[model samples]
Target: MKKKWLALLLGTSLALTACGSNDDDNAGKEPAENKETTTAGAGDAAKIYENKCSSCHAVNLEGGVGPNLTEVGSRLSKDEIEHVILNGQGGMPKELIVGDEASKVADWLSEHK
Candidate 1:
């Protein structure tokens, strides 16, 4: 019957559409944890900043290509600092940073201010 054939064709089409959509969730994605954040030896933010942030921003507010990082803690909250470091701001580039490495650098920046 025409009705039976139409129903079977519709069911097959729906199954195919659903199967294709399942791939959308995994489109060559990378995990956020895999992104590298700042890292310096000796296991602390100060060390991380010394190695990573010091290249651009001066800890004492002497100024550099980036803004003087002094008082950064007072000016920006921890979340703000983390966002800036992770996502970047103004002319800053978005460097690869994530997970504990990101937290360590944020803590170090918070203390340096």
Candidate 2:
């Protein structure tokens, strides 16, 4: 009985060890097309909006903690929008995004209207 228990324990340990090796084996080898797709998705304006502004502006940009920006383009020019993004207004914080990322987000918001 003891021998059977020891054999069972040994088998379980080996099985668990084998399972853990597969994940580490694939960590460093992303395909080029996959990398391009991921990078594109990361920089896309809509994705950026969803990640950064959705919480305050609402998922559809219909407004929530912030005013509805659905027609912001009509209300503000692209430069104005960029200014606001960099400068903030009222309850919003300044410099929420910076540099090229800020410009991309601003351009997206300005065009959505």
Candidate 3:
């Protein structure tokens, strides 16, 4: 029984780690051809959130590993949200998105209230 429990724990850990692995293989390198070059907007912000945040924050902002952000705007101002996005907080890693992309996402999320 103890061996079975240990194995299960290890398996779960491995699975979570794999799921959380960064997909950005070319960090700090030139953007890929498929990458969007236009100015970030509301729609782009949603896409960014989906690709970079949904794994933990949930696609619907319903929360999962990260806190629920359905009404984050009511809780935090746009500046505060942007700060968190740039600096991270608690279990979240910093700079998941930056620059205009981060600003746009923060603006989009700030409207959730």
- Provide C-alpha RMSD values for all models, in order: 10.3, 5.3, 13.5
lDDT score of model 2? 0.79
Which of the predicted structures, 2 or 3, would earn the higher TM-score when compared with the native? 3
Candidate closest to the true structure, highest lDDT? 3
What lDDT tens digits, residue by residue, belong to model 1 across residues 1-113? 99999999999999988877575686896663453532453467666666567667765545599998777787887778889888988888765355666677777667755
lDDT of each: 0.70, 0.79, 0.87
TM-score of 3: 0.65
Task: Order candidates by lDDT, high to low.
Answer: 3, 2, 1
Q: Candidate 3 lDDT, tens digit per residue, 1-113?
A: 99999999999999999899585886776655444433333548888898889899999999999999999999999999999999999999998887888888999999999
TM-score against native, each model = 0.57, 0.63, 0.65
> Which pairs of residues collide in model 2?
none
The lowest-lDDT stretch of 10 consecutive residues in candidate 2 is 32-41
How do the residues 1-113 of candidate 2 rate in per-residue lDDT, one tens digit apiece? 99999999999999999877575666887864444223335688777677667889998999999989998998898899889988999888887666676788888888876
Best by TM-score: 3
User: Looking at candidate 2, what is the lDDT of residue 38?
Assistant: 34
> Which 10 residues in a row give candidate 1 its minimum summed lDDT?
32-41
